[model samples]
Target: MAAPIDRPGARWGVAMCHGFSGSPSSVAPWAKGLAARGFDVEVPRLPGHGTDWRDLEGRRWREWTECFEEACARVAARNDVVFLAGLSMGGAIALRTASRLPVAGVAVVNPGLGFYDWRVRYIGAIRHFLRTTAPIDEPAAPEPVGDEGDYPVTPLAAVYELRQLFRATDRALPKVTAPLLAFKSDADPVVPPSSMTRILRRVASDDVEFVPLHESPHVATRDREALLIVARTAEFFERCAAKAAHPAVGA
Candidate 1:
């Protein structure tokens, strides 16, 4: 994990999260962009990640949340306002964090709310016999800018834990009141469109923006519209954080 990156401006903070298997590098570009715009950016490594798949074998989703929450607490204590942003599984974690923490806003890209494959549901049935993890066959991305920080494989045990996290996120959705932003790739192969719809329908956040990406794949943060994502996310955080700090002159 990288040390906390900060730039002196506005007393604001943004906690950026990478995907389930990825390292800080997954969200690094966005973090740097936000940091350059004067928001302190903290990109923490997810538990059992950035090392190897075996390390993640028996890890639970609670550990992931605990790791991210501790980082969020640190950011919240330093800045007057704080926001959460994440990609893939991190997106789900950010939403879960928003439900618990008093952050100003939340943003996500291609969040993995559920798997696109039918076989994923059966992982639990075969866990005892399979013991280890196996890769699923999928078509390649046309314009792949892979998450270099990611593990090549995912443990079946981790998949079960991730499923639990998604279920918990669904239950906690109505509790999230912060402003929200989401970027969904029209043709994401990893996560389905249902993920975004789930948030729009479930979250209590009245301030929400759902941006559709036509030219990007699952890793939109590092894809063709990568710069666009950075620009839009930074703008959302700025506007929402300002709105949070200074409300309208009252009714």
Candidate 2:
């Protein structure tokens, strides 16, 4: 794991997670943006990420979830309030963490809770013959979007493992109580629209808010609405932290 971006002097902490096969660079901007506001931030690079795609071949979903939990624990220890944010697959990891942890809030951008394509369901059956596929990165945005340092190819076994993670996360959704802010892109090419709907339907969180992004793709953090993501996340964190500190006087 790369050194996490830590900023001192804040009682609140925010832990950000990147997408599957992607490095911390994917969430670096949002992490830094939170840090700039004086909140301690940690963005841990998951196992097999920031390296060759082959390195990610056999890793399981448990490993990724474990890493995310550990990262959240580290931040929770030092801060009175903690918020978790993630992109794509990382959103599933964040949701899993929120289900188990005492987090103040969670923000998921284009969370990959389910796939619209039926072909992804067959990864386990064909992994023995087809080990990997072409790079999953989408075409460049009209503007220069920085590279997220993701793997060049998608690992078949890893994809299967992600499916497992999604199932596990879905099972745990009703246990989650933390306030949730889900950002869905109207034109996302990677994650299906059902991904966000699944979360809304299952999670027990009463304080849920959904924001629709009209322009961004699956990687909203790097899209044209990137700054909006940062601002909304920061605001959501602040509101949740406040609510945690001062619950409504009555009832």
Candidate 3:
């Protein structure tokens, strides 16, 4: 584990998790920008990601969370202050970690709270049909970025695990202590607006803030407003750290 510093000194560390079936490259640019602004960013490649899709097929949610936890430990050991950030399923992992760990705060990009559409509601049925009937090797364009048109066909088991993670994180929201900065793209076709509203309304901490990306899609981390998201997040965490260092007088 990286040593946690009492103060950030010249740098504050951040552990960034990529979405399911996605690689660190997806969020590397965002991390780079944060690092340029004096943040020690650690973007871990999720288990079975960045490799063949089947390599990740047999893996479960624990593998993904454990990988992130290990990375967070390393960053926490080295930096006095650390923030957890993620995209999609990775956002849920960030929330889960902050809910239990002693971290500065969290920045969730398009957090997967719950599916509102019927097609998504019955995703498992489609997954089964695809899994047993026809496996799609052609990757769909990565939303928000649209750089990659190919993605590993999601494994049914892994999707199920993600569903469990979503449920578990929803249950744990009221226990989260870290301040949160959550972003959602109004045009996002993947994550529903209800999920973002629920986080804003139900999360235990009052230090939560929401940013609605006007025209962005699901992957706001890589959208046109990506840089703004990163800047705003860094600013928010910096304020949290400042408040922690020097509290306001009178309760």
Candidate 4:
């Protein structure tokens, strides 16, 4: 886990999570963009990531959630308000974590709720025969998204574990009441469109905005529109923070 920027008098903090099989480097650029704008940030390297795929193969999805929870705890301890953000699988984890914690807001890109592949349902049995599956293709995003440090071959066991995480997140979606901002690349080859749709449908947040990343792929965090994500997310964070400071009149 990278130490968060500890600026004095920083009242708000953001904790970002990387996708499965990926380290914090994948989201470092986005985090740096936020930190540059005076937001204290923590991008945690999830357990069993940033090393060999075999290491990840042995880990379950719960371990990933624990790491994310721990990172959020670190930021929430110092800041009066905290926001959550993530990309890909990290986005899914962020949503689940938000349901568990009291966050001011959440911003995510390409959050995975369900996969395009139907075989994922059978991964539990299939893993006995196949040890690994082909990894995500190199995104042809016109410009480079940098090296995401993704696993060359995804372990079948990990895929199964991800499925379990998605199930748990799907069930917990209704508990996410914080203001939310979500992005989904129209051409995303990884997570299906249902991911964004399901989150919007299930979350209890009255303040929800879903942006479509036109022509972008799954790795929008580093794609050509990466800066767009950073800018819009920062704006959302500020708005949410202001709302937290003064709530609307109620009955």
Number of the predicted model whose lDDT against the real structure is largest: 4
| TM-score per candidate, chains pooled | 0.90, 0.93, 0.85, 0.94
- What lDDT does each candidate get? 0.83, 0.86, 0.76, 0.89
Q: Give the per-residue Cα lDDT of candidate 4 at 57.
A: 90
TM-score of model 4 vs. true structure: 0.94
Question: By lDDT, is 1 or 2 better?
Answer: 2
Candidate 1 per-residue C-alpha lDDT over 133-248 given as tens digits, one digit per residue, 9 for 90 to 100: 54543444455555556667777888888888998999999999999999999988778999888888999999999999998877777777877888898788878866876787
lDDT tens digits, residue span 1-251, model 3: 12233353545789998887678866765787777667789988888787777777678788888999999999988887789999877898899888878887899898887865455456566766765212323223344554532253666656666777888888888888788988888777767788888877778887888888886676666767777887887788778777766777982
Which 10-residue window in model 3 sums to the lowest lDDT?
132-141
- Residue-pair clashes, model 3: 10
Poorly placed runs, candidate 1 (over 4 Å): 1-9, 133-147, 249-251
- Candidate 2: residue pairs that collide: none
Model 2 lDDT at residue 68: 86
Q: For candidate 4, lDDT tens digit of each residue in 102-195?
A: 9999999999999999999999999999999889775565766567788889999999999999999999999999999999998888898988
Model 2, 52-114: lDDT tens digits are 888899688898989989999899898888999999999999999998889999999999988
> On a 0 to 100 scale, what is the lDDT of residue 7 in model 3?
51
lDDT of 2 at 19: 92
Q: Which stretches of candidate 2 lie over 4 Å from their true place?
A: 1-10
